[model samples]
Target chain A: MNIYLRLVYRNIRANLDRASLFFELIFPLFFIFVQGFGLNGIVPPFDVGNGRVISYSLFLAAGAVTLTVINGGTNAGTQLWFDRKNGMFEQLLMGPFTRAQYILSIIFATLIIGVAGSLLVFGFAFPVLGASFAPTWEGALLIAGALFLGTMFFGAFAIALSVVLKSSETFQIVSTFAFFIFLFTSSVFFPASAAPSAIQAASLANPLTYTTDIFRAGLFNAVTPTVSLELGVLAIEAVAMFVIAVFAFRRIRV
Target chain B: MLMAPDQVVRVDELSRHFGDKIAVDRVSFDIARSEVFGFLGPNGAGKTTTIKMLTTLLPSTSGRATVLGHDLKTEGRKIRAQIGVVQQQDSFDQGLNVETSMDLYGLIWNVPKAERRRRIDELIGHFEMQEFRKMPTVDLSAGQRRRLQVAREFIHDMDLLFLDEPTVGLDPIVRRSVLDYLKERVRQGLTIFFTTHILEEAEYLCNRIAVINQGRIVQIDTPENLKRRFGSAKAVEFKLLQGTSSEMASALSSSASVSRFGRDEGSGAYRVTTTRPESVIPEIYRLADRLNLTVSSIYISETTLEDAFINLVTEDEKAVANGGRAS
Candidate 1:
């Protein structure tokens, strides 16, 4: 495992330049601020039981961070495909590390990116929204848990996709399809209550929906009974996806 | 466990197939400690397939093999821990710099942090990659990348090293340097199993070589033994200094000393193949003198590995053709 950690560390340090710190931190922070304030004027605020017009902008901030994590996680598999095409993947296979070690390294790197993105979102949202960003410690832990699992779940999904897809062009099409499907069906842009019954049921099945809801509940301290159930469902899906992904990846012919 | 002084690698019948195509047939061989064993074959032969199986990347279909006394099927992890493999294609992570890449590979082999740092420094100097140590691998040339790849394998002192076509695109100078480094490693008692299509590379580096064709071992012997056994035959080629009459060429072709002969249509030269070049040479000179035929150049040469390969493959093709007709 020390080897796996070192590999991940080396890769992240080298690629940190490719994913410029300015773009990763400052650009997303700027986008969240601009989009949050701009959308505030267009959509009317929601009325919670506390009688305050709740700014859904905080939800957007969380959603943006989650989006960054999702992008990084999905791109992990595409990066492996690129490596394979460029001869790097063959190198790793011939190394002393096992396939499990390789996959774990990817997952570790994704987790770091996801956590960093989430923290950056928090750093921006808490300052601008003031009292509206009041989140309990328990809620923060739950959000962190959700993001960690969500990143691994999607990252593993991408690994499975990498094994089945031969080319990056086909992988892009599949990634785009997966992205929009998760976005439209999840609670990223809207509430599950407003969605139709069948749509709500489908959202319940989508792991991203659970992740988004968990983030929303954590940031706003608005934990409904449904949130717990979604968290449970997401946990089960994360484990199942991880197992399936590892199994599928094991069968790949180096 | 450390290998006994005698054994480097040992295998019983090893086989691997992909779908309907058999990549490695029931093949087996052994290499003594400190020996450089070359797996030689043409493209698409079972060289890479067998190497992959030996390196524990691909499982054999039906076979038993051991490396340094560790069972390949059960102790693959242990075997892999002690072996280093450099694939045919460039396999280093291009995102990292040379030093970092070596450091990461060292860590993978469980080298201590201090040892890894020391080794990285040593290798960077050894490979003469200091100028490019800080640059990303994408910026390095093909030869430079190959140097890093070969250096990365030695970050930790492994008991066995497997290199697949390590000099595929390298120029002669760089190829020699890589081969010399491999030789040095062998002198340090590291068993090297490398594959290559270039026959001369095997002749230069390998103490023992096995030539595989169509998933079967066609021949296995030292370069000297192979040459003495299959490469002693000679070819005598001569070019006509002036255009000879058709009658003179036909008369030359009828000599009993000539085993086989062919005329070049464009150059109008004649080439003859014979095991006894001494007798054939005098006959050719006498015939030319008697006919007043001028000889531009007459050269007698020994057979090469390339010739042996062609002869072996052609013979195999003939056998197959005859078998088909018989069937």
Candidate 2:
């Protein structure tokens, strides 16, 4: 078996317990459930200047899944942090592995977590609250594409963050702040347009905004005109982040 | 039957620096097949740093090394695959139990199932860890953890093993047991690179011992050779009662057999270093009688590896201070 796959397996198995369970599964579900259901009861169901009558709960579901993918990135970074802290990082580097192998394994591990976390969101949202995975195979393919590119981008960011960050305390504060900022500035819980004009402008550049829109487009079976541009920007951003992560990973000392 | 180039390890001008601090300074050495090469040094004397370099855990700053016939820089993964390392610090996958940790390590090293099982049982019995093999590493005692850390390396076969202070935190019997096991393995054609500050362990297990101090190799020779060369000056220690022994220290320096000695400030005991303690010891008593000095206690012992280590390091410092001429 490939060592990178073995490492990814180990990372996934070692976590997924209490601490990771909350981040990867429970926290996003809780947020989506309370906010998704709460807003559906409060807000009058309306579309954003479109012919379709979109439910707020379904919109929150899209944001919730994006959050799951983002959490996967954080999980990937924490694996590097834990390995360094517990001496396994040296062991990994000392094995039949280069630094690139270790970092790639984290990227893959986060990709798995992000996909699984999204599945959990979709599974809950569709059955319990009557949401849908895009109606057509083409719609489903777009969701899959967005999930892959989104997870890859943030996963690379997390690993690159791990290599550059000095201490765990600082890493936690900085990554958490980055995660929340990304969440708030984008369309996970609400339309970026619902926020002030400044936040709306910032969301135009936030990669999560496109990812969330892509996800929402799939869930609502309503592909919009901007999906192609969104996919193109995401693909470029994902490649850039992964390239940066590779460079940073190479420079790390055992 | 021996090929001249069958050295399992060869290092030339190998150096490592952390920023401006030189951790390993242009060190060089070789280990032949099945030879136990002991690296002895005080704390922060580059012993662990050297081990880390050879084990491929840390990259060297300059120079070259080859392990199991692979270059250090380009063939690190190959070298790592062929050698086992027991680091100085005891660490484990805290989430795994002792059994799981051992099993996981064996798996990572690609040890096959049947062989891994056999080695695990053999080592667990050898290291006396069966009682708590099911316990998580977080719950093990310091000594128990250390034993597990050492024994875990035996789960896979390798051409060479690097042990950095392997016996530290172990009880006397266990320490000797571990060394004896290492000796037994060396007899079976395994090469061992051991590092320790304990001179006795080096003297016991090493075919050749390198005394290192301050990132430089002070002396590298067989323990017997090092002892024979540096052990010529035996030490005579005597305690004084109701008297300052500073006067006696100066008087003994003139004796032909006594080369040099000093007084222990805390114990008020005078140590006389001499090639012939027979004459120097009696001269001490004679000098004491004339001075009306009351003797509390006195004894003489042969120069040991501990003495050789101290003397070698002291000579190194003096040589450095005197424009490299003091030695």
Candidate 3:
């Protein structure tokens, strides 16, 4: 097997546990099943722009996929901290592996989990919420791009954070705070246009907002000009975060 | 230039510094094929640092080294591919069981599936880890974890192996088993670069031992030769038939062969430190006859490698204290 694939396999096998299952599959289900339906009568249908209005369930389902990807990215970064703390960072480097291969393995593993978890959410959302699954070729390609770029961006950001922080306790605290901030200020729960002006501005500046927007457009088969702009911004952010992650990784002692 | 073909590792003037403080200072040594070269030192004595540099885990600050004919600076990956290292720190996935961990390590090295199973079985049996093979690593004891860490290295084939305190946190029986296993590997042409704080283990397993103090190699020789050279004084102890003996004390103090004399209160014996045990034993017998006291038991104890190691390190410390550098 190739070195990257070997490492990715190891990562997947090691990380597949009850906590991972709850985060990737169950947590998203709760939001789509409980929160999405619980607010159906009170919140009204979401206006996804381009004159398309969808039920609150469909909107939160799209956000669920992006949320799963975000969690996957966070797990990838958290894994790096654990590896360093447990001495496997030096152990792997002592083996027939380079720093590049090790970091890339994390990215690939996160990508796999992100795509798989998103599919599971979509599978469960359509059945439980009485929604339909139909997407044009363009919409499908857009969804693929959104998942890939979203996984790459968050994965790199988390990896960079993990390397910069010194202790695991600090990493957990900072990551939890960052995760809550990014989730709320973005379009994962509510549309930016429906929020206050300050939060609207914050959502516009947040990359998670772009990821959720692009994913929502693909799910509804509403690939508009705005989706193109969101995809472009996400691609740029992914590349930028990747470069920063590489720089941070170079500073690691072993 | 690379070392001769028989020399698996050649380190010359290799040093490592952390900002302003030096960890390994211009240490030079060569390990021949199938040789068990021991690095003996106290805590913070640079043994692990030297191992880290030689194994290509850490870069050196100055000088040069080569392992298995590959240059340390340029061909580190090549060297890493052909060598195995068991560091002082524990390295394993806590989620995986012992068998799975060993199997994963073999898979990382690209070993075949069937062969990985065979090596895992062999290592588990040799290291006496059969009972915990299915247990998660987080539940293992420290000694079991250390044993697992050392055993996992053998899953992949390598000509040279570096072990840093591999037997630490192990019971005497298990520690001896590990030493015997290492000896078997060395007999089969595996060269080992070993580091340890246990002088007895080094004396038992090392073909040649290097005593390091303050990041410097103070002495390097075979264990027997080390004892013979630095441990010249013999401890001659004799138990008197009579309990209290002021006459025997005076006789022992006035004798020229006895350099240092004291009574061992626990054993009810008189202990003497002397270079010439032959003359000292006879002088005790004659003194007993003149004092009208019967000689019960007497014996000469040989100096051990631990004694020699302390002597060398103590002298090195004194020398460094006087001149700010070890001789």
- Which structure among the candidates has the greatest TM-score? 3
Candidate lDDT (C-alpha), each: 0.76, 0.82, 0.88
Sliding window of 10 residues with minimal summed lDDT for model 2 chain B = B1-10
- Per-residue accuracy of model 3 over B260-306 as CA lDDT, tens digit each: 99998888888998978889888888888988888888888988998
lDDT of 2 by residue, A8-79 (tens): 776665433456656567777777788888878887776633255678876677778788888888888888
User: Candidate 3: where are CA atoms >4 Å away?
Assistant: B239-258, B262-270, B276-296, B324-327
lDDT: which is higher, 1 or 2? Answer: 2
Error of 1 at B254 (Å): 9.9
Best by DockQ: 3
Candidate 1, what DockQ? 0.38
Which 10 residues in a row give candidate 1 chain B its minimum summed lDDT?
B318-327
Predicted candidate 1 versus true structure: per-residue lDDT over B1-327, tens digit per residue: 344569878877799988999989888888898899988777887888898898888899997888978898888878877888888877766668778877877776678889988888877877778899998888889889888888888888788889898887778887887788788878988889988888888788999888777777777888777766667468888876776556556765787767787787887777788877889888777777887887789898876776666665566557666774122
- Candidate 3, residues A1-254: lDDT per residue as tens digits? 99999999887776456576666688888898889888877888856866678988788878977888888888788778878876788888888888899899999998998888888888877787887757688888888999999989989989999998889889888987998888999999898888899999989878889989998888887677889989999999999999999999989985
Who is ahead in lDDT, 2 or 3?
A: 3
State the displacement of the C-alpha of residue B185, model 3, in Å, after optimal TM-score superposition. 0.8
Task: Give lDDT for model 1.
Answer: 0.76
Question: Candidate 3, which CAPRI tier?
Answer: medium
Report the lDDT of model 1 for residue A138: 70
The TM-scores, one per candidate, come to 0.86, 0.87, 0.93
Runs of candidate 1 with Cα error greater than 4 angstroms are A14-17, A20-31, A47-53, A132-135, A196-201, B1-5, B121-131, B236-272, B276-300, B324-327
